[model samples]
Target: MPALKLLKLPPPVTEEWEWQMNASCRDIDGSLFFHPDNERGEAREGRVAAAKRICEGCPVRRECLRYALESGERYGIWGGTTEEERRATRARRRVR
Candidate 1:
């Protein structure tokens, strides 16, 4: 039998995630973007609003949203969007 050949795979692209370095939330507490267990109502909404405020001024906001949407991120606030918001966006995309 002939020698087996190994498939060559390209290295992961780190540059694709470089935008995270410039994200406004980088210096802030991560908890602001992720609700704690048992969190509810106004408290969760307040945290989400605060996180979105930071995202609003982020230079990489669009890139962040694109990444989250493409990666199917299912938790936390990403690119100014809550999990519900991302779900809605995905739903809209499916309908189009």
Candidate 2:
């Protein structure tokens, strides 16, 4: 019988997340970053723009972006970038 191989797992969620403590959006409402159900067009665009504005002054913007890209975060703005922006970045990386 062949021995079963174990899959390598990602690090625990509790690890190296301290940057969140210094984020500019830390004191803001989370709903600002995430849209409500059926939100679309100008409303969603406005919300995303507001979130990115907050991220512009974040002390941990780089770290937040790295985490989002690494974790495949598919919603909300991070590091001043929208979900569409992140998706484009991922696509570019894959092409490289």
Candidate 3:
């Protein structure tokens, strides 16, 4: 063998996207977004409300909502919107 050459590959890309920005719920318990199936009524409402509050203050709320809608996310609170709210958004989008 006369010579062997190796080509260096560029560094792997690790830039964060807008959707990957720090979230307000980063410090919150994930369980709050995915409450127990047995949880109902006032308890569930309180949990959902708390999660939504975090989402309300999130800087990437719109991106979060878009991600949720595009992914067809059917569970948990996202972008301060409940599953029912997201359903309405989808319906409205379809009408447009």
Candidate 4:
């Protein structure tokens, strides 16, 4: 069998993203309810979608996302983005 790969959970995320991620997912089963028929493969996508909505209604949402992206946060929820999404974004912005 191909070696079982272990996907890292990313580095420590900022307290703000952590709070938003947890908070948004608190009352709602964001994994399932927030986005209907959400497959695990699209978990990150779901988080991003949910994050936008949460940010729209949040007071310090921009600040939180700014802190996350500027600091190169590589973890759970950051800047209203998932680890994979963030990596892809940064990669594109890299000066080749």
Best by lDDT: 1
What stretches of model 4 exceed 4 Å from their correct place? Answer: 1-39, 42-52
Alpha-carbon local distance difference test for all models: 0.93, 0.90, 0.83, 0.59
What are the per-residue Cα lDDT tens digits for candidate 1 across 48-82? 88899999989999999999999999999898899
How many clashes in each candidate?
0, 0, 0, 0
Regions of model 1 farther than 4 Å from truth: 1-10
- TM-score, per-candidate, Cα-based: 0.87, 0.82, 0.76, 0.42
Worst 10 residues of 2 by lDDT: 10-19
Positional deviation of residue 43's Cα in model 4 after best superposition, in angstroms:
6.4
Off by over 4 Å in 3: 1-18
lDDT of 1: 0.93
Across 1-96, the per-residue lDDT of candidate 3 in tens digits comes to 778788999876655344545778777788988778788899999999889888887988887788889999998888788888999999999999
**Could you give the candidate ranking by lDDT, starting with the highest?**
1, 2, 3, 4
Candidate 1 vs candidate 3: the lDDT winner is: 1
N/CA/C clash count, model 2: 0
The candidate 1 region of ten consecutive residues with least summed lDDT is 44-53
Residue lDDT tens for model 2, 1-96: 999999999877765888898999999999998789999999998898888889887899999999999999998888888788999999999999
For model 1, give the RMSD to the true fold. Answer: 2.8
